[model samples]
Target chain A: MAVQEAKRANRLKSGKLVNKLVNEYWEDLINAKKTGKKVVYTTGLPIGPFMAAQDMAWIHGEGYGARVAARHEEKEPQTFAENKGFNRELCSYARTQMGCAMFAELGVPDDLNPGPIATEIPAPDAIVTCYPGCSTGPQWDWAIERVFGKKIPWFNVVIPYHMGRNGSTYMKGEEFEENVKYVVRQFEDLIKFLEVVSGKPYNWDKFQELMGVTKKVGKLRMEAMELCKAKPAPASFFDWSIQIAPVNYLTAWPGTVEAMQAVKDEVQERLDNGVSAVPNEKYRIFWEGIMNWNKLGWMADKFASYDATVVAGRYTHMAFWHEPDTIDPEHPLRGIAINHLECQLNLGYPITEERMMTLSKDYSIDGIVFHGARTCRSFSRSHFLLAENLNKKMGIQSTSFEGDMVDDSFYKEELVNTRIEALIESLEAQKSRG
Target chain B: MTSKSDRSSFYTMGVDSGSLTGKAVIIDGNRQIVSHSVKQLGFVSQKAVMMAIDDALEKAGLALEDITYTVSTGYGRKRLEIAGKNLTEISCHAKGANYLYPEVKTVIDIGGQDSKVIAVDPSGNVKNFAMNDKCAAGTGQFLEVLARALDVELTEIGALSLQSDADIKISSMCTTFAESEVISLVAEGHTTVDILSGMHKAISGRMKGLVGRVGMQQPVMMTGGGAKNIGLVKALEKTLGVSIFIPDEPQIIGALGAALFANDFATGIRKKVEEEQDLDKSRVPAKDCASCSVQNFQLNKN
Candidate 1:
């Protein structure tokens, strides 16, 4: 868990504020154990606001897995899970968090330390498993409880897939309302479950206030991401990936709203001053999959070296921005269910493809980099088709490479390097012709 | 030959250090090839690359210092200390094939340990490309492994495949699985020619997938060491439904392309120097970095 600062130039100074915010968030998690605050581990959903409302500490499994990968410490834990007969094909993030639980049982091996960021992953008082997008993530929650071998209280919610109803852009009409009602009923059960765990009555009024704050945070984050639409993008997709921690993990934290505002102001100032994230940016790229957490910095510098900037990624831009303006404070749970069901990952391919096309035009993308995550089939599947559709529909050339989100062994640096170089060569040729 | 004393005479060099071979080409100011050489690579690819350059230098009656610029290409291009710049073999292969066969729209390069399909424009610019993953299923290395397994000499397998009397098919494109299948076929009293032909067909099948990724275009050219295999060429022709084009020396195409890039880079440098010499030296001018080869050098380090 040794965090190395990236050596790239023109990094946003405001990124430090978010990093500080994340560090404090982790500190709060550690202090939760000592303060007798009920700690809950959950899959990514809109449940963080509710947890905050209930005065509980939330640890998102996927967020911690990304942190593990960013520190280049996924190997020992991933291997630990694989050695115990878990298939390597399972989601790397799931395996990584699972391995952390195993380490809790049989202490971390010698020559390895959990380090500052990974230290003291408190046992969950309750588990809320929400399958917003990922099919493999629901199993992760059940597996974690078994790993601990504890009689832990847990609730699971599965949202129906987001295909457009009545020919709308996404889910709509009575069908969408029914889906929301189903998830709302599940959320009510979850609220009851949380009330028993914390020994307190559910506060709908406080929850409504937190949901409003969450909407503000999402709006600020989305506006900051949209600033990259400038000709000389003030931030690269890699920058957004690093800065995504607050929105992804700390959305309900106290300073998260202020932290997001600071980021938005900084990006706006850069856009005004014409300060590009990658100097001498020539080609703008739209990244089309999960960030290779282990190679985040390396890949950023690689693209920058070719005078190409990865301006935006759907994962970073859409993770927090689930139509912030549409969240109804009066009916917060229904709003949450609708957003979760209609999130980018849960949407049908045609809808996703349409979104990417619109973004490609809005961002003036020259090409796309489709990273096929080795362990995450949900994101990796149909990438070739998507790239082809973009090329045919928008005349945008693309390159595809195989990699894993958390597993470093699944990536071949040289292979990806060659692919990117070839892409730049094509871009250069096109520019020259014009 | 142009004398070394002539300042206007520019000689550019290119070295391509591949997985199994090293190639070098020297071109004169008029962009005509002066001399070219290829050497079998050893454990030290850098040394083999240097040897290839030395052989080309000796043939051209020139010294290394006489060359104005050098650009390296291929997998081991980065390891060459002498290269002023390095480019990926994908771009170099496309450029080389386009230069060799201007009508070629697609270039399928099967090298030592990998295969790639590149789509090129009429102007020798790469439009798109596709490469095999981290597997050696359809490459010279795979052929060598199977050659060793069949107890047949590598050079003779292509001709032996051409003489096959029975049509055969190898189901697996995985190198290890195909080798096992070859062993099983040998035990079943299958002829070596038929087995080699089947292996060639299997390789062609894998190549078809790569070609399909970047949609195939007519007037295709084949390059690299694998292109020397007549059996693979014929099998690929049948699989792709097109007549293939082959250079006289396919393995050195990447080196030729690197040499061409060196010539272009040298021309740009010369033009910049003349422009700078004509301007006011006292005034600091805005640097035009877009066309500079040094930018490519910086990119290579990353």
Candidate 2:
């Protein structure tokens, strides 16, 4: 018998643009820190445009995670953090960041040589952050306060939930308007912290201009996601995982928009020619919950084995969808506030399930693969309920397996393969019955 | 271990090669258990699987070819080349549990490395399931480690655990951590029975949380090698506040389910072939009448 090589994902023009843009920003972050230019390592913040206006460098926490995870370089940092008080139960990205911090103390692992995302990740002069209804808040707080063995100026931007107070768990109806006002106030305060850290007064024009760019990116994201509705999507969500760099870190950059446009065009080309991301795409699957980042390539190949493609996912498109009308540059901070407010993580469990159902219908998804990520309590907690509801209401087939965002030890590949293969069988059976 | 054969007429086999044990069940066309074997799994799961298969085959007075269809399941199911097909232990366990107790809507399988709770639909298909695979703290492997720590035989620990009169607790929630805790408890002069009782309760507490994840729909059937531990069963019963049912041969449930699947798969293939033959009979001359007749006879018997 002859040997057969695994088929590799085509490197699209958009993918190259995204990598170049992300790598350049990361290199600039390192250079900015070395040259005495203030660089901010942050979680989800509404200040990218503000930082871009000055010499300040901004690195998104999730963007850092994607880079390290891409190279299969998260293990050492993850272990370093786990050895410390930070449990594996914290978000995988958070732990990796913590582990990356210990490179000086725990010493850098030979493999890391401290790569673009991790080893070279400078200690944040300040970490601009907010909860946005996920585990990122506490993890970000830890990233600033304790990860470096000393506290730094950390902006804990409090975004109101349902009732526009600190406590409401669900996103409510009328409070959404007031909730935006409250979150904008927090963003305004976050700008104050940014001013103090950068020693320069905040600029409204820069902020508004960045918001306009962000709105464009958001619009493009919303539009590109609609393409998955095609029978065989032009790209899988795993491919979209690469887009997180441009989406999360370089949000308002023109190159990011250009990159996204290139993606949209390529996908259109694929649809025109009746091409698919997964060859002979027999099953269209919608993935829910956080990613199995370390095993992403393996998971994608596994889907290919069954001729299944993860056409859409909650993560790649984000949990919430908004249009141009939703993002107003005049009230930029307010619009950014509302964006986080409507984020999938902030919404209550019931709303998330409803969104999952909508996506299932929109994508014509035959199955759902919920990654029962160990660290992400909020998302992992609702999988069973979400799956049960989707099964009961939509008659959709769903399956879940335990995984960690970047930790390899948390999941067994064979176990995941069997569960997915089993799900495929169940989906086939369901279709046959219909 | 190979059990004495109750009968010698068996034509179908089910092999469950798990993380730690390889179990095989041989059933006749009537689905009666003719022979079964349970062997400790080794590094080479294939060898262990073959060992179990050959034992069952020997006890049933049969050769490998004599078995019509072999369905392999469990963790090592895919590794076995001898099996005609394979199914996940979740589906197989549900099917196996349903065969033993048809009303069973839940299956709590505490296997060597992981503990799983599955909700079974009326047709024996799994509705939803939760697993505690990442941690060995609440599984058979946990008990094995604790048994070694206590210097007690695993089989005896269960019976001895029931004899314990003292109330004891295992503080650590991790298997390795609990081993150290067990050492300290022993240094403090806890009896083997008391420590074993605590171990069972610790496992029960963990299993209880896992069962809650899937939600309980009883009557719950407990299978796998862990089901053989009476003390763990009692502990689970107490924690869950419900009576749990165990099959006569709990360890072979997975293999039994695979056997049932094999029987069904073989039967389905035969029916399809016969239907094709019937279609051929009308459109063209039958080229292979002898083979068709043999398959036709097989279909009729099924």
Q: Best candidate, TM-score-wise?
A: 1
TM-score of each: 0.89, 0.84
CAPRI category for model 1 = acceptable
Residue B134 of model 1 has an lDDT of: 55
lDDT of 1 by residue, B174-269 (tens): 789888989999999999999999999889998998788788998999999988999889999999999999999999999998888888888888
Please give, for residues A176-197, the per-residue lDDT of candidate 1 as tens digits. Answer: 6777788889888889988998
TM-score of predicted structure 2 = 0.84
Query: Per-prediction RMSD in angstroms?
Result: 6.9, 6.3
Clashes of each: 0, 1
Candidate 2, overall lDDT? Answer: 0.75
Model 2 DockQ class: incorrect
